[model samples]
Target chain A: MTGAPQDPADAEACPVAPTLWLRLEADGTYRVGLTTTAARRAGAIVHYRGPVAGRAYAAREPAASLESEKWVEHLALPLPGTVVEVNPLPTADPGLLNRDPEGAGWLCRVLAGPTDGRAAPPSVPTGAPE
Target chain B: MSLEPSDEARPGRLPSWRLLDLGRCAPARAQAFVEAVAVSVGEGRVPNTLVLAQPSAPYLSLGFHQSFHEELDPGFLERRRIPVLRRVEGGGTTYLDPDQWFFQLAYRDEGGGRGGPEDLKRFLRGPVAAARSLGLSAELRAPSDLVVGGRKVSGNAGGDWEGAHLVVGGFLLGADVRAMADALRLPHPALRPLLRGLVAREVTSWEEAVGVRPPWERFRQALASAIATEGRFEARTGAPTPAEEARFLEETLPRHSDPAWRELPPAPRRAGSLVRRLRIAGPHGLLVFRGSGEHLAAIVDGDRLVEAYRVGDGPTDALEELGEDGDGRAAVAELVASTPSFA
Candidate 1:
């Protein structure tokens, strides 16, 4: 019955995007994931294959593949960057992507340059509400 | 990019899409052909395509994400000499035979404008209209299901394959409910009849819906023509390229046939000897529960009881208890309460 925490820190911690949830960490790496809305829309995720950690990708390129009961989608990286780490939890139990998309359900962490100076943002938009 | 009609286009004319009519082939070949088209289309070598095919023999097909061990009884499949393969698109386990007509559409993913969800809705509309044109009151359900009078007639799944967006679905002309029930790994032996009844109640076929079984040729042409008219596509019949066929024989079939691809990792070990694991169709979704002596793990997904706990020490004893009052849910709840709640 209670509302989710409205703290700015928590809000800034995980910003919502059209297709994914983005979290800007202090270490400068961005933790990216398929938003809970997107996850549920795709149905229960039953399998996942993520890009290898340390692999660099161009913006809009596929970084991970997710499969649910009724659909399969490839999540593209929003920015050009090298993947620092990929979450192991969803690989073993893909349902975690639906259960806790912003927490244990994160897909990967990428090290990218600052976004403020960029002329165009990533192909997918960011900053929507979760 | 500005939107404009091509110079080659005449007034009220739309682009033509190729249709591959791969009539009755081995189940593995059918799966392989779809994959080949996805690859070819994604590479921009082939035009946006609609593939129509059916399996010459019966086989079990698993969703891209499903674990074979969890969804199927391998011994039954083996005894029946039914080959099993995983598809690139997502959906639950299904039995495919010559009776069902498979349709797969693959097109280029034009970024922006329409997203995956919207595209699925648009893609399914043509087929739904086609079914309705046959005098069946079919409707499109969310996420891509075609239902008639509240029972499912067609099930669909879609995904992106490299640069192509693909949706694969099928219309059931007829089905073997008993074979389907036997193939799946139900929790208890006594549940087979229940599973058969459940499947019959939940699913429908062309014969069941229309009270007459239309010829395969007639149904195929009707669906193809209807889709062509609805989508503004000119259907051109074709076949897979020789290269695609070679790839299917060499790469696709062998990889899917691997044993490791079908197995699931071992379950987490817990205290007490494992007694039974039951998968029941609950009111909500699939109920799957496993019990090891006194420990039980129960999980419910949607209307089906996907997971459940063990009611008694053995399968026979559990079936007896389930039959006691003819109430499975109460027995499940009692077992659930007796076991420690992990949540």
Candidate 2:
């Protein structure tokens, strides 16, 4: 979500639930973050927990939790992987997720284990990596 | 987070809504039951469902994101022996007792709303209709509120739970303004009366609006019918599936019982000076004020800078309109010193 190539371009494309994305890094690591729709629906981010750095998750398994003005729910990972690099900003100040969700607010970096990325939610858009 | 349903759904006909009327449950159980429903719906164990229930005792249910310390006065809660729990949904902090009848809805994504405007409409339509069914003129205040006249009759909040959408709100069958104020950690003593007056003025219930508290069975029947009609679902009396029941006892009840869980999510360490904004005498205006002893800054009618005596921990330059002389400014600040008002 933060610094990777993800999909679901804008707010209008998102609904109440978070529309998430998985961006594969050059080193084959992966990043997961929600789009603007989830951030906006969340209103101001009050608290956020980054995915655990070493926890392995099955594909589409929720990796973290967040609370906004709306509801508290887990942030699911679209790919099966072991969490590697946890973004520090949103962990310290959850508001970053609202301000720059697609950039600094990306949930975590994961070392992809398996799956061809077919497990992502149906509406996830494709993004060109920066 | 997953629960097994007692029965699988019929193959052909699907209910637009499944109704569960939990007439009276222990205070904590009443509040936590909805989480069970949400988990069931999210996991496909149950379809869209609506639940009606009331807590036998009084307690404070805070929003998921609300800071427990900032929103509550611990001394008061301890004195009253009231247990506080953080609800899964988000919104304002609320006080609940047996007199209040609550409504909760869990909708799966099959044909459900995606959140935002559509969700708000879906959230309040049934409650608004139920209020009207009782012969009160009720309408929705955007995002989530059921208002009658200009006062809010119901407090509501909605959001996604796993793969399902959940909305929880309630109508006060009685008014307890003083208790409501006493429970809050007021920023100032003066705001005490203001909050009392504000809650009494802005929040209304069946007892206050109608001559009598709405008869229990009658009101709930109307609620079920109205909710079913709004969603175009058939209303039928149903009990919680074994899974929902199991989770309520095994999970939610125990978690809410733990005192640490009540204060589990801490509030922010430092907060900016907050403004207390309350509706003024007129419907179109607001009185927004912020300050501490001897100094205050206020904005009346939204734009007028009525006074600028304080901001953060110290006094600032007073409004020039009152004159640059310290004497004149001090005189004005003292006149409205105790509370922010129009005159």
Query: Which number leads on lDDT?
Result: 2
Per-residue lDDT value at B94 in model 1:
83
lDDT of 1 by residue, B116-188 (tens): 5556667787788878877777888766778887677787888775456788888877867677667888655
Candidate 2, clashing residue pairs?
A1-A33, A2-A106, A16-B114
Find the number of clashing residue pairs for candidate 2. 3
The residue ranges of model 2 lying beyond 4 angstroms of the native Cα positions read A1-18, A26-28, A40-74, A79-99, A111-130, B1-14, B115-117, B267-272, B275-343
lDDT of each: 0.64, 0.64
Task: Please state what fraction of the native interface contacts candidate 2 reproduces.
Answer: 0.32
Report the lDDT tens digits of candidate 2 across residue range B114-219. 6443575675788888888788777887656677777777777766655677878888788676787678775445444545655677677777787687787998
- TM-scores across all candidates? 0.72, 0.75
